[model samples]
Target: MKPITRYLGVFVCTALSACASGAPLSSGKPFDLTPPKTMMADGIFYSQRAWPGTVPMQVAIVEIDLQTRGLSFAVSSGRASDASEYRSQTTSTFLRESGAIVAINGGYFSPVVSAEGLGQDAVGFAKSNGRVVSPASTPQTAGAAKAVVCFDRRQVQILAALACPDRFANGLAAGPLLVQDGAIKVDPKNATRHPRSILGINASGNRLWLVTIDGRQKGYSEGASFAESALILQALGAAHAINLDGGGSTALVYRDPVQGPRVLNRPIQGGVPGTERPVATHIGVFTKAKPKT
Candidate 1:
């Protein structure tokens, strides 16, 4: 559990300044989704914006340089299975417990609401630290979990669920692939909006982006559709991206050395604002602390 201050930086924008002009920040075409403020560290950058639109939205983005030495990724693991039960925890809990610098909610799971998200099971394939935590769901059983992302110490691969490999150091399934081979894969007709969590990679595959869009809170942040989410990632330079488990489980947590673990988004669960829903799986990022200045 190293102190995050050695590897984390903080920056923020006032709501007044971000929305004063009532104009979206430049982010190419289709839509304007870049956050006004950006926080940067040695190998990581974080940004969040209060986007104004017919449906106002709030978004948080974290980009990490995979080529940075000592960087690693992890997926939450559960107890051995006799049945198919898995343990669950909030994203913030996962960040703190796993000693990861950043963490976000992972794939979809059953029993949307539970006492503590115990006895839950991932809706699709899940592997943690080389262990097959759960197998891929069959076509009839797979709903939103249509794609998978697998990663090792130095590489990451995104593939359709059916093509997922038998082994990977860490991986999870959760998507209707948003972008593939630098093209938008999300159908424009699928316009349903809700809070969202997405994972993406740059064309070179040396950068990884994690995003969370807050929604369902009228007059604040209403959320974005799959198409919008994909466009957002495109604007951020992601060539490939996938939607993760969202809705009440949409959350991104960062460990701030000074402030401790903090939830970067206003998550609404069970109709309660700021409430965090315990979820079945989470993806975490680790990095070596920067040398003292």
Candidate 2:
């Protein structure tokens, strides 16, 4: 119970780019998702479009509770935007006002654009748009990131880990709330699942489950990660898990509890910057502080 290093100065000086141990077995590259045209206000849910400029930039995911308290794990870049707004600032201004460059500590690390940011505290992988991507910039023999064992918020809620794809680079899949009776269907070439995914999702009470992890490697953080998709969401019963953003920075923008907030994921192209910024340190927003009648 002693591993607390909370440095939320945001992007400390951006430089990183050192990861890579192994994993990569795909000879059919080509994934698709256009995502654009969005709206959801009054507490907001985001998506004005732009996301890394198109072609599924790098990754994205957002699942805020209602406003802010404990369940708001977001992830962006790959032309980022997971809209469910409740702003203040920090998390590197949602990854540099929507162009991507947070580069370490949020979910699947990578975004070190630094004209003078990130400063120090190094990890690895930066330089988006021109391309560099991560999971530690792979190619060692393939297969490294893999530790899926969730439900550890002190050990029964969900803590999640799945990062060793050579020590971590991208293939995130944060947790809590996925209720289709929970879910578990592993085996993405299993070697433990290399940072592959499946996170816990309880959202402080029982939000169900609907998490995913299958980045499919393209340049970096190569193959078999997501740790059997976070042990298949802790064998389908997530308590509380972590790890957001995945290759092309995995995207998941769902807000349809009956149009309760109104914007439901499908971002890509259009002035961008609704909000997004990978390579994080700490950002878990949840809101519901208005009850006392």
Candidate 3:
């Protein structure tokens, strides 16, 4: 996928500085819940809020009924040669185009490197609908990732990569698991706050959450750290959760009966008309159209 505007580098640089000398972490509390709004449809629900009194943070959450809807992974380009054609788009483009009810960016991989199956794509693995769309090799280094999360549409699981089963109906391997069994799992060293996108599933495996927290904008939202994200998910009822490709790549889109398709969060990067940064993959929730009666 393509990189975002120049400020992204600055965002990272500033993040380091702030991490070293920022105020104490947020108190574990429920979201402030102002401007309360929600949307509900067949097997889906959406809501948003802004946490205040600190540095202000914006977050959007979508809950999908896995039993009534479908959950799967998608990529802009399916073939190696067509890689350039489908590199990036706003999360909504993938959602609206794929007709998904809920969606978020998937996994981490350099498009150019992955296109040739060279670096992580050569090592990291992704599979969609029972086929090995991306291959895997030795994990390069131990603890390269804190956790590996995958799903088979019917169920999603989190664990060490070595313990992850061989294949799935559709899945992605990306993490630093934010919440496990409803407990926060952030390492103190990785506790820096930044805009974050996270995915979570309930113990029942029948409900899923797609979340995004906006950051890097002063007086608007400063973002969330790995621990904050975990607390947020747990507050929303996630028994298991994982952080996905975040930073400027964080994006969330929802379709409304009246608003149609809209980007619910203010994506920090090239999210202008026809300019959402491209990403390696996407996770989406869709429902099978019932046969006509």
Candidate 4:
């Protein structure tokens, strides 16, 4: 029988106890092996795999062509609880409503005590097209107000959380920075295991990596830690990467040729399989289009 894919949106209470015991699969080298299946269109790359890992990991990579595809942050429904109070939406809903070809859940939010089934409060530092979508949600807490990913007109950058200014043209703050200049930075000693969401940029900065590791579901996928997730992104060729809001907030959306747009991985939700947690922000990918002149 196929592995079960449903998961309740809850944080994995305990660490793997062994996630830090072994080296990353593939020796932390770029995975040169061709994907079992591949699809490329509109400059977007897609691959499917049950990645080789200590856990039964499921993954779908959406590599958007930054040079061709339009990448931008979309506030959930582009609406807040009170239109600036608390914004939120489903990944699928964000995709369909924003007309995004694909989308990955954005950075962290408030009232989010842990990674799963946590309450979705206000947003962290999130900027779109040079506008602050939400102000700093917290008062410079540790790992707070940091913009792990920054994209300017020239190139993308992986900066420290505090490095991000109050606002920028485009950027989001979420992470333990994974790779910088092609080197993995996550501490190998990290042993926690939970679902993961990563956003990365390749050597050329043209290809963006949107990676999701399904976890919290037994027999299907166990999940990945900061170090393990770093290894995964590095192997996939991310010159610079950031761990996004992971755990139950980990979600990926893609339009299936046959099934149309849908969340690909089984997100942990209320201890249920295939349930989704509403999120505060989403970085969306749309078909190639000329910038409005």
Index of the highest-TM-score prediction: 1
lDDT of each: 0.78, 0.28, 0.61, 0.64
The 10 consecutive residues of candidate 4 with the worst lDDT sum are 6-15
**Per-prediction TM-score to the true structure, in the order listed:** 0.85, 0.25, 0.75, 0.77
RMSD to truth, every model? 5.2, 19.7, 9.5, 8.4
lDDT of 3 by residue, 1-293 (tens): 22222212221111112211212236534454233334345556556666643668878787777776443544333445543323545566677777775567776655432122222241255665565566543566423344556766557776656334765566666777888876777775665777788989887877788898987777777888887788777766688898887777787765543434556666776423222445666776655632111
Candidate 1, 3-106: lDDT as tens digits:
22232344332222432222222332234433343443457767666554567788888878888888888889877853655766888888888988889999
- Residue 25 displacement (Å), model 1: 11
The sequence of per-residue lDDT tens digits that candidate 4 reaches over residues 65-99 is 67763444333434333434344576777777777
User: How good is model 4 by TM-score?
Assistant: 0.77
- Candidate 3: stretches off by over 4 Å: 1-25, 32-37, 69-77, 80-86, 111-123, 141-146, 162-167, 189-191, 257-260, 270-275, 289-293
Q: How many clashing residue pairs, candidate 3? A: 1
True lDDT of residue 105, candidate 2:
27
lDDT of 2 at 168: 23
lDDT of 3 at 33: 27
For candidate 1, the per-residue lDDT at 164 reads 59
